[model samples]
Target chain A: MFFYLIDVFGTMAFAISGVLTAINKKMDPFGVFVIAFVTAVGGGTLRDVLIGRSPVGWMRDLNYVYVIIAGFFLAVIFRKKLDKLRTSLFFFDTIGLGVFTLIGLEKGLEINLHPVICVALGTMTACFGGVTRDILCNEIPVIFRKEIYATICILGGCVFFLLKALHVPDGLLYILTSGVIIATRLMAVVFKWSLPPLSRD
Target chain B: MFFYLIDVFGTMAFAISGVLTAINKKMDPFGVFVIAFVTAVGGGTLRDVLIGRSPVGWMRDLNYVYVIIAGFFLAVIFRKKLDKLRTSLFFFDTIGLGVFTLIGLEKGLEINLHPVICVALGTMTACFGGVTRDILCNEIPVIFRKEIYATICILGGCVFFLLKALHVPDGLLYILTSGVIIATRLMAVVFKWSLPPLSRD
Candidate 1:
């Protein structure tokens, strides 16, 4: 039940990001909704496929469609409001990264996947949607070059696994892992930090 | 032996499409090769997951890496010559699409997927690279527009299954399907034909 809230909120955040990218591109209404839907679910779709989940999540939950459509209009109607706080979008986006990574890690753990694969899965769930949106918007994925995006997800997953190894209580571990991610991401942005680019030859 | 040529040429074709998109974006050499590799192999990777193949292609074969690097430099060197052509890229692109659809169709058949899924895979394999590149370049995919893109792949897939149904010789079927796709795409370009938008309502 707790994780379900995280799932829905993560979806909403991803959907908003997609809608904003569409707006930036001046895509029409239909185009906006399509990108929104794909962005919200694309990462999870890839995750489901990797773990052999048949038919995928949106196929089972019609509400996912409605949520994305609603998010699109919400963005369109609230364009001025959003534009006013364009800076906070980064914070909201980081919160999404935290929630998504935890949800993904829990899912992988449920399936009894190896720890490494679970870490990869959590990272993908948190990052792939933005990557998809960036591609659709013809922008380089910010995660690949921005303030330690995938790195934070990896660290969150590692925290989760460490808590599990210590036999920490599930509820407490959940809070700890997600808190670490959100805090780490926010601090990184506040500090203007990122992994250095690969050295030139 | 013949399939090998088709595979290599298809990779080359997809790589060129990626390079073109990257060049258009003014990406660095590493960035260009990254886009080229993603554009060239993303569809196949998606297909592999759907069909339960592990590790993906590029993770399995370093040859794909070599191809994208080679294609990137080749594009950088030949951009001037390429710019001189009125439609040479389009011509080769059509050929690439045709051959790619055939290979995708053959792979789907090997895995015994449903005919419908097979054709979908064929269209995907032939069109998805450009779609990814376009998305990364922050534009609507050309194929999603009314272009003779996905349509050509569909037409070619139909030719493939039709030839098999008629007990056509294997080599002849390959030639026939590819020829149909190339001819249809070129003809559409010549005629400036397109599918109607879905939202006339």
Candidate 2:
């Protein structure tokens, strides 16, 4: 129940991020809505496809679409305030990474997938949409170029199963795993950390 | 055998088209290869997922990857000549559209999908990468804005079935359908034609 609440908030964060990207790209409202919708659900859709889930999440739940469209308008109406709170937006995105990863892991476990596959799914759920958005915006994704983003999601998924193996209390494990991803990503960005680029000959 | 040949040609054309988009976007060579591969195959990937095909085509056939990469370099080497030949590019793209629609219809029929769904898939196969390219390039897709591109594919598919029901010869039907799409698209371009805009308001 608690996880579901946090999951929706994460969706909101993702929606805002996509809307901002479209606005920055100078897209009209219809274009902004399209980008935001894709950014918020693109990862989830890909996961569902790989797992052969019928109907997909947003298709099954109208609320997901509603929330994304609402997020778009909220961002547009409050663009000035959001612009002033760039740090807050970053925090929101980090929180989103945690929420998406945990839920994705849970979904994989529910489906009785292998641990490795579940971790990969978790990483994809948290990262693919941002990658899509960045590519569409004509930039290399931040996950690939800067900050320790996807790695944090991967590590969180690892910690999730490790805690489960030790049979840690469920609620505590969820909170701990999410906290780890958020902290790792936020710290890496704050401290200007990054993965090494591929060697240039 | 002829159908397979047409399929390969369509795939090659779409891959080259994708690589050119990546070049225009100024992506790295690896990025160019990736975009080209996905652009060529993205619609088929979606169709496969929808129809529950296992592992997907490229996963089943690694040659698709090698072909895409080769196409990428071929584009790079001939970029200047290609840049000067928009008309010729349009010809290849139209040929690709005709072949892709046939492939999509065949795949759907093999899977026993509804005829409506098959036509939709045919339209998708012919138009989706172009739509994806425009989205990635941050422009409204020409499919949604310009001439009756997807419409031609749909019409050709309909014509194939119409001729089949009338006991048309197999070879003649194939040629006639492909010719219809190619002629439709070329006529639209040469005649300054377009679909009615949803609204300019």
Mind giving the per-residue lDDT tens digits that candidate 2 earns over B1-201? 777666676777788887777667555554455567667877777777778884455545656656766777777678767777666767777888998887788789998888789989888877887777666555677678767888888899899889878999978887888999889889988898777877779
The local distance difference test score of model 1 is 0.77
Question: What is the C-alpha lDDT profile of model 2 across A131-187, one tens digit per residue?
Answer: 788876776565544456777888999999999999999889989999999988888
lDDT of 1 at A137: 70
Instruction: Give a tens-digit lDDT track for model 1, residues B1-201.
Output: 776666676687678777767666655554565578768887777777767775455545566667766776777678667666427666666777888788779879999998888999888888888887777766778888868689888988988898899999999999999999989988898899898888967
* Candidate achieving the largest TM-score: 2
Interface RMSD of each: 6.9, 6.8
Candidate 2: CAPRI quality band = incorrect
Among all windows of 10 consecutive residues in model 1 chain B, the one with the lowest summed lDDT is: B54-63
Question: Which residue pairs in model 2 clash with each other?
Answer: none
What digit string (tens of lDDT, one per residue) describes model 1 on residues A1-201? 766666676677788888888888999988888888888888777777767676887899987777777777888789779877666666667777888888778777777777766876788788877777776776777665545778788899999999999999988998899899999988987898866543212
